[model samples]
Target: MIRHCVFIRFRPEVGEAEKAMIFTEIAALKERLPGFLAAHVGANVSPETGMDKGYAEGFIVDFADAKARDTYLDDADHRRTGAKIVAAAEGGVQGVLVYDLEIPD
Candidate 1:
């Protein structure tokens, strides 16, 4: 399995409603694309200080394998949603961080 994690530091002008809508759009990709095993999106509620840096929102997407993840990365919907996220982020594309992990069977 492949776990695709994304963290975002939204711009000051981006409201809570817009943030929620961004996450909702991301979650909806699971239905539009294939090989999505699971997905979770929400705000950072960690008690640990200084851990999250400036990233307040994030999402994790689980895919069956690397191929699935690759497909998702190339999907049109994913690109559109990513553009929205980047636009809302502080430094455009630089305001987002993406990490992919491979889960052993």
Candidate 2:
């Protein structure tokens, strides 16, 4: 299994409504993409202070395998959604962090 984690530092001006819209768009991808197992998204809720380093929100996508993950990377809809995230980020793409973790079955 592949765990695709995305942490975002949204611009201060971006409001909750817009953030919800972006997350909703992300959640909607399960219906369109193959092997997209699950998606978990929300704001950082850590008790520790300053640990988020401005990345106060994020999402995780679970894929059946790397092939599915790669396909998602190439999907046009994903590309469009990615663009929305970049646009809302603090420094374009710099405000986003992507980490992929491989889990044994």
Give the range where candidate 2 is weakest over 10 consecutive residues by summed lDDT. Answer: 21-30
- lDDT string for model 1 (18-92, tens) is 989888888888886788889899989999988999998899999999998999999988899899999999999
Best prediction by TM-score? 2
What's the C-alpha lDDT at position 21 in model 1? Answer: 88
- After the best TM-score superposition of candidate 2, give how far the Cα of residue 95 lies from its true spot, in angstroms: 0.4
Candidate 2 lDDT for residue 95: 99
The TM-score of candidate 1 is 0.95
> Which regions of candidate 1 deviate over 4 angstroms?
none
Q: Across residues 47-105, which tens digit of lDDT does each residue of candidate 2 receive? A: 99998999999899999999999999999888898999999999999999999999999
> Would you list the C-alpha lDDT of every candidate in the order shown?
0.91, 0.95
